[model samples]
Target chain A: MNNVLVFPMIVPILAAMLLLFFRSNTAVQRWGSVGAMTVVFGTSVWILQQVMLHGILRLDFGEWLPPFGITFVADSFAMLLVTVSSLVTVLCLVYAAFAKDEKRESFFMYPFALLLAAGVNGSFLTGDLFNLFVCFEVMLLASYVLMTLGGEKKQLTEGIKYILINILSSWLFLLGIAYLYGTLGTLNMAHLSVRIAEAGQPPLLTTISMLFLVVFSLKAGLVLYFWLPGSYSTLPAAISALFAALLTKVGVYALFRTFTLLFYHEPSLTHKVIGYMAAATMIGGSIGALAHRDVRKIASYNVVIAIGFILVGLASFNIEAIQGSIYYLIHDILIKGLLFLLVGTIIHLTGKTRFDQESGLIANYPLFGWLFFIMILSLGGIPPFSGFAGKLFIGEGAIGAGHYGLTAIAFLSSLFVLYSLLRVFLIMFWGESSILSKNQIPLSKGMLAPLVALGIITTGLGLGMDYLSPYVSEAAHVLMNPDVYIEGALHNE
Target chain B: METIIILLVGVLVSTATYLLLSKNLIRVVLGTAILSHAIHLLLMTMGGLKMGSVPILGDQVDTYTDALPQALILTAIVISFAVTAFFLVLVYRTYQSTGSDNLYELKGPQDE
Candidate 1:
């Protein structure tokens, strides 16, 4: 019942409300969002420390008690994501201040973005199924607003497909929940887990699990993510940076959370599906990126690549593998955020997102080119960068779990992704100067500050693994063992 | 009676799915709306169709209908309503701008 668990979520909501009130005042909204997100980052770090010091921090709304009352449970894994995504939100907001279209800014995009952050945090922390749906709705609603704020024809068209696909997926999600509740008679996640264990795995459970898989996979942009490349590519770079960093990962997080918590009974059936999907998403995402000539589209496709990689960790369902996945998830969030912001800046300056159409601004803006290079390398899982750690752990762990074929697929697909990302980087930055070679928008200090801060932190994360690994390993340990979560969630210890 | 409701739900979902798979944007919206109705019915059915006294504690009621599903369906109804509204607006905007309601004719970022 620690009050702190509620603040991380409440802070952004309050910020979003205040931001909505000040929609006309861009300066107030901008500073207000930064201040609010900074509070979020602070409190999430505080919660992470509290979770490390204490065990699980549970906030039961309305004092109704667990298995009845809605709960916000903060294990290390939840706290860690909140911490990273909060930092990312703060950075993206800074980027949004500069790069977001002035029209979009005046239209209350910032508030919806904050609301989206709130939804994401709620989804990460909730301890039940129904609440998860509600949180997804909140996130998606905000995302719908943010994506179409500009009223651009492209945004509307792609937004149509995105909304349709998600709505269908959400209906399926509700249908799954209905079935689970009817059979088990509980919507509480911990209670459901307890019930499933007592009753053993039922045949209906498999069907429900598949339904959940489809819903989460669509969000995660896994192999089923046909809507993602188009929808994400059409977005303004600032908003898409935030989307790329946080949105799909929410899906990956749900998949990890639920499959680990509830569907462990039929790992042979469930894990195999996850494993194969992971491999396919990884390979398909890479190939999709290779096929996309657009820089933003390529980055959007790489999101699928990371989704696939993280799934590989979860699919293996071993300590080391899950640990690696957690690390990779963090690395991907940071790396992807960096890519979107950096590329957004490029697009912001050049007004061209297609790789074939742009180049040689790197000749003048060496800083952007260099930072983009770091992110590109990190994204590809190159050695000693942030991405390598997760790959190493997942790869070795997959091998340890005797998933040799998946491990090979994981390694091989990454090579293709690496080649594609590098090709885009070279063509956009190294080759002939784009038409904008003569004149470039000066990089604002506000923009430069967040990028440099993020760059240093990425480097720090890569170099300071010794300090970070223990915390990551601890979070993975919590994920590996679900009984601890169930007890902490249900019993209120 | 239970079998009839389940069969009806099946029919609704199948019709909805067929509509959704069509290339017309309006049909997809229709499909989603119908699909939601089917799901709401399924939710109510899942909670059991037994008619009973209201769920009032200490009323000495012999059997009480489940209240949770009703509450959940209320929320689901509101959400679906909002979603449908948003979809319609989005559809209108897509039409006004893209000048087409055929899903394929809207815009294809998939290829070029």
Candidate 2:
């Protein structure tokens, strides 16, 4: 359990150092990135096993006692996120190896990629607020580099905006941490939870909670997500895909962590606020998606829409709602990753991103087209795909929680998402074949292989939900019953 | 002394917010820099300011300043510095490419 808990953090840092020595060799850097992600993937599997056998694995760094040192807690929830992130990253690296232009290797893309993996894993596993903030910075730094990897005019302009917004958010996050630490006097999340409970919902606590909410909302791309379409749309397809896949989920994870662990008492206010924001984010993002003609913009807006649903799940604040939220998070990460990868492949094949510029992609490239169609359908929350199952759980949870209006909103927004995706798929794949030239759609085995694998896994997720439900339920239980987290952190202190 | 520091932080925050609202990219960068510094001071102040007493434990002074917030602020200061440097570089690159420093002119595809 110790080894499994440590693997995600150790492998990436070690691989990053090795890559620094072999920086001159592009091939080594590429293979090194793949090998590192593979190890992370393997370790995630082992950690999942340990999590299944034992309830949770808590590793205190430097063997320092709780409330003083950093701790990594791996429960079913954390392990699930780590596994999904590892799978997406591994596939993205494989796809990038082929889909990327020749300039990818020269840009230190491999090292930054590993840093991103480390950041995601760190965020998922850490049991401290400040440590989570550090992880956010680590991930944001890597993302800034990745956004500007190409160094083109568009990339630089958009990348600056992205970095600026995220930097400000980090500062706000720091301020929130200071408030939390000053008021609570402990950085350990579990211990802080008990402190907050003991402190009995002071005004200052509510203010700090609101600050944390805003900071994470910016990262999660809720209503303040205007930066996303600009920044993510400007990046190369694969990088955009990866960012679209996992970055916002990290923010959602933070939202879950804070609300569940620290701010659970004020459900009427916190959950209501999140619910309202979720509805607004959904409508705005759907409209944005409908308005965009570019593939990347459409996908990016869809990410915002997905965040809305997750927020709704959180807002419900019941056992089923929390479980649904976790389940939806897992589903969204995989399906969104697949959608981005597929769109990247489409761009790679056609050299065009707008629907107006390209036509009949399906006829030109049948394999890529069909895979993209399946991913698009799944993304639209069609049946028998991962998206449908997630939406169903959240919808049911909302209904069960007696939020009938929100349930209706969720259903309507899901349709809007379906409409937007179907519009794009139809335009790109099923339209006239006359517009496309005989370019032969250069499909690389490396890129196509990962897309296919991800597509299959996303499909399998829908079918295997029965097996996955127990884990999601357990995660929800852990989050709902904060005593376990409190005990785990304060144990032997 | 703590009151003065709090007043100074308020001034810095207001000034930075004004700059952030401006149209110039350089002003926005400066605003972020100033705002982060203000936040660091605010964090330090939250730990309760003590005059002439270092946060580190020593032989003479019985009451050491609270060290936790100092450590946190120090880490934050370094992180803010790195982020500021990165933002500066990004602004420079954006200026080089777009040939202008006005953020209003750098509208994205949606603007088109």
lDDT, candidate 2, equals 0.84
TM-score for each prediction? 0.97, 0.96
Query: In angstroms, how far off is A184's CA in candidate 1?
Result: 0.3
Clash pairs (backbone) in predicted model 2: none
Candidate 2's residue-wise lDDT over B4-108, tens digit each?
Answer: 989998999899999988999999999999999999998888888874577667899877777777888888888888888988988888888789999888776
Q: Which window of ten consecutive residues has the lowest lDDT sum in model 2 chain A?
A: A433-442
* Candidate 1 local lDDT, A1-493, one digit each (tens): 3878877778888988888888778999888998898999999988888888888888888888989888999999998998999899999998888664679889888888889999999999999899999989999999988888898878888888889888988998899999998899999988998998888878788878988998899889889988998888888767898999999989999999889889889999999999999999988887888887788888888888889889998889999999899999999888888887887777777787777787776787888788888887787788678888899999989999899999998988888778887887788888777556446677788787788878878888888888788779878887878898987899955
Clashes of each: 0, 0
- Full-model lDDT for every candidate: 0.87, 0.84
Clashing pairs in 1: none
Q: On a 0 to 100 scale, what is the lDDT of residue A209 in model 2?
A: 94
The segments of candidate 2 whose C-alpha lies over 4 angstroms from its true place after superposition are A1-4, A435-438, B51-62, B109-111
What DockQ, on C-alphas, does every prediction get?
A: 0.76, 0.69
Best by lDDT: 1
